[model samples]
Target chain A: MTFFINSVYFGMVLTFVAYEIGLFCKKKIRLAIVNPVVIASLIVGAVLVLGKIDYETYSESVQYITYFLTPATVCLAIPLYRQIHLLKKYPLAIMGGVFSGVLTAMVSIYFIALIFGLTHEQYITLLPKSITTAIGMGISEKMGGIVTLTVVAISVTGITGTLSAEFMLKLFRIKNPVAKGLAIGTCSHALGTTKAMEMGEVEGAMSSLAIVLTGILTVIGVSIFANFIG
Target chain B: MKYLKQLAIVLIVSLLAELMAYLIPLPVAASVYGLVLMLIGLITHIIPLRLVEDVGDFLVENMGIMFVPPTVGIIACVDELKQMWIPLLVAGIFTTFLIMIITGLVTQALIKKTGGES
Candidate 1:
C-alpha cells in the first residue's frame, strides 16, 4: 500500500479513474449539474481525505496533467478562428454584449463581496470567477487570492450558468442565438459553453468565441478592478 | 507523427507566448498571449489551421479532466470555504443571473438597433 501510494503515478491514475467515472455519470444522467469535473474533484478529494494522503503528494504527481492547461488554453484559438465569421456579421452586437457582460460580472462581484463583508482575499478570489479556469487561476494567484477557492468559484459559476442559462434566456425573452451564446460564455466560461453548444450551432460558435474574448477581457480587466478594493 | 507535429506547433506558440508575457510588462496571463498569438497566426495564414487543429480539438475536448487536480486542492482550504460558502454561493448564483440577463438583453437590443440579421 505504501509503495503504491508513493509511486509517481498514484495521483495521475486516481484522477483518470475518477474522471472516467464522472464521464460515465454525466453520460448516464445527462443533467447539467452532473458536471464531470465536480464529480471527479469530489472523488479525488475524498480519497485524499479518507486515505490521509497529503495534498503535496497528490499535487506533485498531478502537475504532469496540469502542464497541458496552458497549451489547451492556447489552442482555444482554433475554435475562435473557426467562429471568427460570426464576429464579422454582428461585430457591434457581439462585442457589446461580451463587454457589458464582463463589466457586470466584475462590478456585481465587487459589490456582493463588499455587501457580504468578505475579506480582501475572498473578494479577489471571486473576482475572476466568471472566466475560464485556465485564465482565471492565474489572475487569482497574481492578485493574492486563494487559487483553490477561485477554481471552485469558477466551477460553481459555470454550473450555475449552465443550469440557469436556458431558463434565464427564455425568461428574458432573448431569442437571438448570438445573445444567448455570448451571455452564457461570458458569465460562465467553458462549462456554460458546453450548454451553449447544445443549444445550436450559432450559439455554440458564438459561445466559443465568447470564451476566448471573455478570458482576454478579464485578464485586462482584473488589474483595474483590483484597485477598487485596494 | 501528425499528432506530434500539431502538438509541437501548439507548444512552440505557448512558449513564445510565455516569453512575451515575461517581456511585455503587462499583468496578463501567458495563456492569453498564447491565444492572441495563435489567433493572429491563423488569421494571417502564417501558421495554418491544419497544423494545430487536430491537437487543439483533442485538448479542448479533454480539458475538463485536467482541472481535476487543481480542484481537488480544495481540500486544503476547507476552512476558508466553510466560512465563506454562503456568501460565495450567493454571489456566484446571483451575479451569474445578472450578467446573463444584462448581456443577453443588451445584445438583443443592439442587434435590433443595427438591423442585423439575427
Candidate 2:
C-alpha cells in the first residue's frame, strides 16, 4: 500500500480517475456547473486531505500531466488558424471586442478589490482571473500574487462565464455567432470556449481566437495595471 | 506513426518557444510565444498545419484536465480563501458578468457598425 501510494503513477492515476469521474458527472448531469475540471480538482483535493498525503507528494507526479499545458496552449493556434478568415473579415470587431473585454476585466477587478479593501497581493491575484490558467498562473506568480488563489479565482471566473454565458447572450440579444464566441472567450478563456463551441462552429473558432488575443493583451495590460495598487 | 510524428513536431515547437521565452526578457508566458510561433508557422507555410493538427487537437480538447493539479493547490491556501471568500466571490462573479455583457455588446455593436455579417 505504501509503495503504491509513493509510486510515480499514483498521482497520475488519481488525477485521471478523478477527471473521468468528473466527465461522467457532466455527461449524466448535463449542467454547466458540473464542470469536469472543478469536479476533478475537488475529488483530488479531498484525496490529498483525507488520506493524510501531503500536496507535494501528490503534485510531484501530477506535474507530468501539467507538463502538457504549455504544448496544449500552443496548439490553440490550430483553431485560430482555421478561423483566421473570420479575423480578417471582422478584424475591427474582433480586436475591438477582445481589447475592451480585457480592459473591463482588469479595471473592474481593480475597483472591486478597492471597494472590498483587498490587499495588493489579493488585488494582483484577481487581475488575471479571467484568462486561461496557463497564462494567468504565470502573471499571478510574477506579480507576487498567490498563484493558488489565482487559480481558484480563475476557475471561479470561468465557471461563472460558462454558467451565465448563454443566458447573458440571449438577454443582451447578442445574435451574432462571432460576437458570442469573442465575448465568452474574452471573459472566461477556454472554459467558456467550451460553451461557445456548443453554440456553433463560428462561435467556437472566434472564441479560440479571442483566447489567444486576450491572453496577449492581458500580459501587456497587467504589467501596466500592477502599479495601480503599488 | 503519424501521431508520433505530429507529437514530435509540437514538442519541438514548444521547446523552441520555451527557449525564445527564456532568452527574451518579457513577462509573457512561453505558451503565448509558442502559440504565436505556431500561428506564424501555419500562416507562412513554414510548418504545415497537418504536421501538428492531430496532436494539437488532442491537446486542446483535453486541455482542461491539465489544470487540475494547479487548482488542487488551492488546498494549500485554505486559510487565505476563508478570509477572502466574499471579496473573491463578488469580484469574480460580478466582473465576469460585466465583462461578458460589455464585451459582447461592444463586439456586436462594432460588427454592425463595420457592416460585417449581422
Candidate 3:
C-alpha cells in the first residue's frame, strides 16, 4: 500500500483521470468557466483532502508533470518562430499592442490590489497574473510572491478572458485579427489563445505570437517595475 | 524512435537554456531563456524546425493539462483566497478587461495609423 501510494504513477493516474473528467464536462457544458485545470484541481484537491493525502505527498509524486512545464513553456517558441513573418511585417504594431497590454495589466493590478488592501505578498503574486502560469509563477517566485496565489490568480484571469472575450471584442469594436488576438492572448495567455483560435486562423496565429511577446514583456516589466509599486 | 529523437532535441535545448540562465545574473525566467534560445536556433537554422516540431507541437497542444498539477498548490492557499475572495475576483475581472481593451485599442490604432486597414 505504501509503495502504491508513493509511486509516481499513483499521482499521474489521478491527474489524468481528473483531467479527463474535466474534459468531458467542458465538451458537454461548452462553458469556459468549466476550465479543465480548474476542474482537475478541484477534484484532485478533494481527493487529497478526503484520502488524507498531504499536499507535499501529492506534489512529490507528481514531480514529473511539473518538470514538463519548463519544456512546454520553451515549446512556445515554436509558435513565435512560425509567426516571425507577422513580426517583420508589423513590428511596431505588435510590440505596441503588447506594451500597452503589459503596462495596463501592471498599473491596473497595482492600483486594484492596493484599493482592496492586499498584502505585499498578495500584490506581488498578482503582479504577473496576466501572463501564462509558467512564466507568471516564475515572476511570482522572483518577486517574493506566493506561487500558489499567482497560479490561482492567473487561472482566474484566463477564465475571465475566455468567458468575456466576445463581449470585450464587440465592446471595443476591434476588427483586426491582430488586434483581437493580441488582446486576448496578452490578457488571458494560452486560454485566451484558445478562444482567439476559435475566431479564425489569423487570430489564432496572432494570439500565439502575442502570448510569447507578452510573456517576455511582462517578465521584464515585473522584475524592473515591481519595486516602484510598493 | 522519431518521437523520442524530437523530444530529446527539445530536452537538450531546454537543459542548455536552464544552465545558461543559471550562469547569467539576469532575473528573467529560465523558461524564457529556453524559448529565446530555441527561437534563435530555429531562425538561424542551427536547429531545424522539423527536428523538434512533432514533440513541440504535442507539448504545446497539451500545455493546459500540464498546468493542472501545479494548480493543486491552490489547495494550500484556500484559506487565503477565502479571506480575500472579493478583492481577488474584482482584481481579476477588472484587470482582465482593462488589459484586453487597452491592448486591442492600441493594436487597432497602430494598424490604422500605419495604413494597414481601418
TM-score of each: 0.89, 0.92, 0.87
lDDT of 2 by residue, B1-118 (tens): 9999999989998999999878987656788789889999999999998899898988888887887887787787788799788888887799999999989999999998998653
Best by lDDT: 2
TM-score of chain A of each: 0.83, 0.88, 0.81
Report the lDDT tens digits of candidate 1 across residue range A1-230: 78978999999999999999998998999776677878888999999999999999999988989999889878877877887877887889988999999999889988987888877888888999988786788889888888888887887788789878888899999999889988988898877876786687678667777877888888788888888875
CAPRI rating of model 3: medium
Best by DockQ: 2
What tens-digit string does per-residue lDDT give for candidate 3 at A85-143? 76777778988999999999888877877688777777787888888776787788878
Give candidate 1's whole-model lDDT.
0.85
Candidate 1 lDDT tens digits, B5-103: 999999999999999988986546687788889999999999999999899989877877877886687677778688789878877899999998999
The TM-score of candidate 3's chain A against the true chain A comes to 0.81
lDDT of 1 at A20: 96
* C-alpha lDDT score of every prediction, in listed order: 0.85, 0.87, 0.81
| Candidate 1, CAPRI quality class derived from DockQ | medium
- All candidates: CA RMSD (Å): 2.6, 2.2, 2.8
Clashing residue pairs in candidate 1 are none
Q: What DockQ score does model 3 reach against the true complex?
A: 0.61
